[model samples]
Target: MNSYFVTATGTDIGKTFCTAGLLRANPTLSAIKPLLSGYEEEQAESSDSGQLLAAMGREATGANISAITPWRYKAPLSPDMAAAREGQSIDYAALLGFCRAELAKGPTLIEGAGGAAVPLTPTKLTVDWIADLGLPVLLVTGSYLGGISHCITTAEFLLRRHISIHAVLLNESPQAPVPEAQTQATLERYLPCRIFPVRRDAGAEDFRTLAL
Candidate 1:
């Protein structure tokens, strides 16, 4: 099965939006959130992943939400810190099992929580987990000011690690300070990945226009 890991420069950069966009053309594709943090009991009732599933016109029942996301922290903090406060840790092998199970379902899109380098456990970073999954990644970067450095560093790290970066989505969030083209041009020179421009406040139809 063809699969791709969806990571971002930072949290709420539209990883779920871009992933759901892909599903518009390829309905067979399924999404997985391997280690979702900041999911309170109240938030889980209307989670980001659940919203993505809904936009894709899918019910939230089938996707790997619980098994993959073993640690759903109530506090809106980094995964590692949240798990530490709860006196628990993310089990890498169990997370891998969940990923493999999702891939077996069909073409899978695994969305990383926070950023690529987010810490899952005390020792394991999210990028290390993405490497373990062994799928090509599509990075989602918002077209906001100061995003150039974050996006380039992320892509460079992935390249240095020998991970295949399928594409980059430059998400333009609502009322965000826009980035200049020269900054994007700089990133093009340093990073080896395709960059896509996404407009702000895009609906499902607008998101579907994204080619990757």
Candidate 2:
């Protein structure tokens, strides 16, 4: 089965949205957010974990959500800081093992938290985790004012490390200075890869072109 590590330019930038769309389009595709920060059990249905559950046609119950996303933190911060707040730390080996096992189950979409540089532990950045997994990335970025620079910088960092980027999803951000098309064009110019524009409030059909 094919597996992809879904990462993004920053937190709340549409990694989950892009992933949910793909999952909805292909119902058989399994997925896991694996690690999450800023999770509240009371508002389970509104969180990213809940959204993913809905997309997968699973009930948004605590047990169901936890099955896919095990590492959850209540604080809205990077995993390193959030884990520190709870007097815990992520075991990199365990995290890698969990993802490998999940990927082996089927065509899984493994989603990540925060930005590429955001630390999962004291010394392990998100990029390091992606590198260790050795999976192609479904890179997601926003179409905000400084989107071009952020996309280019993150793209360069991954490409320099020889990470295969399966595709780039330019998720539309609200009240942006320019249209999403402009952002996609700029990224295409700098990045030698396929870039897809995901409009604001896009649905599952909007992402079918990716052939998920």
Candidate 3:
């Protein structure tokens, strides 16, 4: 089973949009937001995984959503801290098992919350989990203001850690100061990896542009 994990430099980047793009490209694919903290009932209206399911035309059924994601936290913070606040703890093995199960189903897209090095457990880093899952990664970086440096630094860190990045998605958030096309050009000029800029309103066809 082919799998890709989408991670970014920070929160509020277009990781969800990029994930939706991938799902749109391959409707049969399954996705995982294994640990979704910061989940509020009101915010479910704008939740990442929810939007991804919608983009893929899948109903948020119990079986489908549960099969893809096993953990859901309501605190708007990193998993470790959020779990602490809620008197809960994250199980790494359980998360790995869910990811393995989803990958077994078909080509799966695993979306990482926050950035690469955010804490999953007190001692374990998110990138360590990414290493454990051992899937090729796709980075979704915001391409405005301070994007170029962030993308390059992230790419360098991934390289240093020996993670295989399939490509980089230069996402233009709705309120980005600069136009996406221009940022795309600038990113292409500096970054060595393949960069694809996704629009704020991108759908399936836009996602299909990535060869996975």
**Winning candidate number (lDDT):** 2
Query: How do the predictions measure up, each by TM-score?
Result: 0.86, 0.97, 0.91
| Residue pairs in candidate 1 whose N, alpha carbon or C atoms collide under 3 angstroms | none
**By TM-score, who's the top model here?**
2
Q: Give me the runs in candidate 2 sitting further than 4 Å from their true place.
A: none
Evaluate model 2: give its TM-score: 0.97
- lDDT, model 3: 0.81
Q: Among all windows of ten consecutive residues in candidate 3, which has the lowest summed lDDT?
A: 60-69
Provide C-alpha RMSD values for all models, in order. 2.7, 1.0, 2.0
Please write out the lDDT profile of model 1 over residues 1-212, one tens digit for every residue: 47899999889888877776776656767776766777765455367666556655766553334643445776677887877778887777888887888788778888888898988777788788888889898899876767888898898888888889987877775555645355556667877777766665555576555554
Tens digit of lDDT per residue, candidate 3, span 1-212?
Answer: 36899899888887887888788788777677887888764555467767777766876665656555677788889989888898999998988887888788888889998988889897888898888988888998986788777888888888778899888888886667778788888878876678887877787788777786
Q: Write the per-residue lDDT of candidate 2 for residues 1-212, one digit (tens) a residue.
A: 37899999888899998999999878889889888899999998988889999899898898998889989999999987898899999998899999999988889999999888898877788889999989998899999988889988998999888899989999999998987787788889889878999987888788888865
Clashing pairs in 3: none
What are the lDDT scores of the predictions, listed in order? 0.74, 0.89, 0.81
Q: Give the higher-lDDT candidate: 1 or 2.
A: 2
